[model samples]
Target: MLSLHANVYAHPEGAATGPRRELRGLPLPTLVGPGGGPPPFLQVLPVTFEQMQAALAELPRCDCEPDGFFLLTGHTPEGVFWRLNGHMQEYQPEDADGPSMHRIELNGECPVASLDAVLRTIGWPKAQLAFELVREGVTLIEADFREYASQPATEGEPRRPDRGASRVPAPCRGRDDAALGTSALEANASYTPWHITFGTYGTRLHGDRRPTVDLEHNEYGTPYLPRNELRRRRAEDTLTGPPVHLSAEQRRLIERLLPEICHRGGWRIHTAAAQSDHVHVICDVRSEVHGEKVRRLIKRWLSEALNEKWPDPNRLRWWAVQGSNKAIKDESYLQNAIAYVEKQRTASR
Candidate 1:
């Protein structure tokens, strides 16, 4: 079973506009075929509050109470089901008296076959879906499924909402192709891996000339900036702390700690290298685990280990907050990334 979280906004023209209604612990059931088989792929099943309530009562209960709506897509003969649990929160739009916006925070699981169908059922355009997965709140592992479009949509099928009609602003539309493209380096789904690169805190390289927070530069490649100017700026800026230089022993310690960290996280490390001021890794994680979360876990665990080993008087900073995470699209890209990390040497400058 794959776990997913989603934030869906209801369009003002098509959504409920009266006082908020609370329907906790509802079971939303999907429409079934004449023979009681699973609903056809991409079929929109209208979910009601009462059905959600009923479904909630029948399903196994956890400690947390269901605080939102539910949608059942289909059921398999093997006793498996595709379901969505959504918690509704109301927000006021820019116009004070305008129709209230409903933001549903959804969490649930389904068979992998239902992923593309569920997304298409939600009526989000492909571009918006990709952008939200990569840069939106809580990077999603399911975002990798953006490649699912390779499968043709059911022909002559009319698009419909999984629940109710809701129009959302198309934020990712009109963006460059590169921005919307899947980070997965390969077209094949099974072999995808992530290539990550991060820098130690206070480390400055001559090539690190781009402004840190520029999302546009990140979407496209960074523009040309003079190496001399970047180095000069680094010398003049007092805020950027001194560059970190790990000793031979420190590097050895990192090599030992990284594999341990990866093992604890259930991630398979393909290759990992710790340079004087930076680190590079290529690893495979659960399809549901996003790169950002994995990067954070590694940074946290290693920082803890390093701090315990060397207690500093002044707080010893370990890593830069942001890192490069590129999905390995194919075997060729994966091999190249692994080679790059393994063969990298300390910069001469």
Candidate 2:
């Protein structure tokens, strides 16, 4: 008894890396447990936009009324699911004051028989009401489910139209609706990130010399060193490097302090690597966390740490004088940043 017809989206390498299977011909891979054990009781359907739309069309309409269905989109590793529970509402985009677009969830205790009829009509053929588990990420997606789905026990209680409350039990009688009790069903998935990364300002990352005030307002911003100081540093780095050179110890100190700032702010630091002109950091910050605040914390810590290690006449600013204030709302963007951080050397070159 698999969820979502089990065979809906079969991948050759498994759901995790499959090229995207279709029911047109390919067979769904058997979902095995750890150590090549027996097939797991639950099966996952990693659906694409088109596939999801097709499946949505096949879902049976509610016999209990207030027609509803669980809708999921985006990947679990991308933080898309966070928007569903309203935690990442800031990520939701707005254009010219238009109505906000969001998925809707409707819960009513409909008899399983009636629900099955809808599935049958839609050609599910073996669809069943199972526990719906959602996965988290940039966007939410339904990953798997239990054979026995429990719905809230509205028990034939007709909801008042004026009150906008309805819980009918005609769709799946005897089947418990208690499981759907939550405001919305979240997916059952998690991510194991290797590291976090952040971008720094400097000539290596961004080239050009301008006044500090003008640079701060520019998209790229001024280099980490002031024009007067950078001119001297650039001269040193000219033969020795492209920017001022920090000893391995200085670099190490700065790197170590990055994780400290992220941790103090209740964020996770994946990794930090310093280049001649810029440093790359991978970390997870909250939606409400200000980018400037994060930069300031890291800069303050790094400056203090470096000063303690070695007092220099030329004070160094850790970040470029520009603002990189923007949140990544999509998985692709987040992933790109991760890769860029890992290969900061190549990216800077």
Candidate 3:
């Protein structure tokens, strides 16, 4: 049995009862597999960010491996919500006084059936319950299952007015068809261009010298080191030699090498520019190809070509570990990326 808790909210459309009762450590029967083996029991914990962090902190450090999975569900007014599916891998407290953060590795499949059971237990009618997976989180794989129990269905056959199921309209299939597009090319299109920018070792920028960005909560949630603090740290941590800046010959070499490398790697280089301290490239890659890998490959090829030409005995690091890898979602974005890379000097000035 899996014990779960929930803080129920009033349904926007109003429920048969005023509002569903809050579940408090409610024990749910474990599912049995076809082979009569005990299937994995998942606890659906609908929590706020603060609550989730608190729950994670309360967990005691144990040598025993995780036996169950947890589904973290949360909502925002701006049509943003998260349905994170993962088991606690490790827990470590920031300090003796602070709360602990659990490092969770995301699982590919979320137990929708289990979630349905949870909703059913909470008295939400099956007909009213609807969810769609949305890809918006920083962890490219992490997605939200946006629930729409209150909304009316937009597509498919009309429901009978007399039926109990009719009280709660069918799930609204919002822009699934339109967003995916109709044609085969549109469906499997890899038209998204990548805007890659990498700096030479030891250059300060908007987001450098900070704690690594949490891929799960990439934008707002992550803490970044202040620019002044970064500059101070850089000043304090001086190197034996000067910072690695690209020479005129090196920049020229990069310009000559990028197109050939892109062609060989089955990528289309729309625009590329090599600067004294950094490099930028706007390239079209396959739909499945990761932008990070593309940037790494560009840096690797450039570094190798440069190393062969000007073999430095000191073995200096050519490129910084961090770089920008933005995807151009549309034609306008692609054009903008191309222009940005092409006129890199003018933009910098």
Candidate 4:
């Protein structure tokens, strides 16, 4: 049976069940295969930026061996950030600039369990990174081929079959409607586009990038900490801060991948923007698709696609080990997200 330790609160006098009770647990169960087979050995490789680029290039010709898959992660630099407090604090343009983009350490025990779960917790910066890696990985495996049409015969007399036999040439039908009767096909005469545009991401101006390190705080509360203590706490949290300027090449890559990702997840992208360090997307929940699944889909797809030509799985290694799924149940939150995405212009603007 699957079980773990439960924390039961006791009275100050030592009697049980007086104040609080919390539940915690050890590893629950080895939920792997149905009945239980051998413990699955998941092969994990941490790829670097140059390595990832190489992997992406080589991916086109390489064969994907059975029982093998990989995860991609990327990271930003660390630093201190000062907030803009209305007009009282002068917001300098230089403050908008931070550090150059680079990969973070991915070894040791990952804080989260899986790549998909980590994305949901931290939001889109990590998701964008994972998406970039997965796209390259995917490209390595499959070519993005455009649909081609057959040309009419250059010169030929339309051959007539033996009419006495009673066989007739069939009427042309849409690929999907070929099996339908002529009467049914006539009832639905409108032509529908073969592919749908569920979402998009791009910058209007050339080289426009977006800033990261957004700050939001509760306005209702004023903490009573002494001046020195407050500064000390903030300093402690300053390590591994946000990234500064991101390359235009990185931004463009994300723009191409987001829409493709939405299509793969069976979800519609209401709006999307590829910023310097983070990406913003306003998407509707596909009844069948959840956030965590979307995160994984993007990560794996981008990594594989990029790695195809680059042959380096580690170029864009910013994702956390695990990503989480978040549900947007309210319309207001969706609106705000969309607005935010629309306003993201790089410092140059």
- The lDDT per prediction is 0.47, 0.35, 0.44, 0.29
- lDDT string for model 3 (1-349, tens) is 1211211221212212111211122121221222333221122223322443344433322111122233334333454432333333222223424322222233222234434433432234522322211211101100112222112223432322231111211111111122322223333456557777777765543434543322332233345444466655654475323468887778877877888877656667797888888887887777676666667567756866786788553444476556667777778877876776778642333
For candidate 3, list the clashing residue pairs, or say none.
Answer: none
- What's the best-to-worst order under lDDT? 1, 3, 2, 4
Candidate 1: tens digits of C-alpha lDDT, residues 72-176: 344556866545444433333355452222333444555555544434433443413221111122111233333322223334323232332222332211112
Best by lDDT: 1
Tell me the TM-score of each prediction against the true structure: 0.41, 0.32, 0.40, 0.31
Candidate 1 overall Cα lDDT vs. reference? 0.47
Which of the two, 3 or 4, has more lDDT? 3
**10-61 per-residue lDDT for model 4 (tens digits):** 0011111111111122111211211232111121113322343334334322
Question: Where is model 2 more than 4 Å wrong at Cα?
Answer: 1-243, 314-320, 345-349
lDDT of prediction 2: 0.35
lDDT (10s digit) by residue, model 2, range 27-114: 2232332343321223222222234334444543211111122321222344322101000000122332321212212222233443
Question: lDDT of candidate 4?
Answer: 0.29
Give candidate 4 regions above 4 Å deviation.
Answer: 1-246, 309-318, 322-325, 345-349
